[model samples]
Target: MSRERKREGALYLCNQRQRGEEGKASGKEDEREGETRTD
Candidate 1:
C-alpha cells in the first residue's frame, strides 16, 4: 500500500510540473501574438 501511494504521489507531481511548463509556453505564445496584432 505504501509503495502504491508513493507512486501515485510521484505521478501527481510529474503532472503538475508538466502543466506548469505548458502554461508558461502558452503564455509566451500569447504575448507574441499580441505584439504581432499591435504592429
Candidate 2:
C-alpha cells in the first residue's frame, strides 16, 4: 500500500473509534434523561 493511503486508513480508524465512544456516551445520557423525565 502507498504511504498516503496507509496514513488515511489509520486516520479513518481513529475517527471510527472516537465516534463509537461518543455514541456510547450519548446513549447513557439519553437513558438518564429518560429516567429523570419519568420520575
- What TM-scores do the predictions have? 0.66, 0.64
Question: How good is model 2 by TM-score?
Answer: 0.64
Which number leads on lDDT?
A: 1
Off by over 4 Å in 2: 28-39
Compose the digit string of candidate 1's lDDT tens values, residues 1-39.
999999999999999999878878777876788899999
Give the range where candidate 1 is weakest over 10 consecutive residues by summed lDDT.
Answer: 22-31
Q: Which numbered prediction scores highest in TM-score against the true structure? A: 1
Residue 4 error, candidate 1, Å? 0.3
lDDT of each: 0.90, 0.89
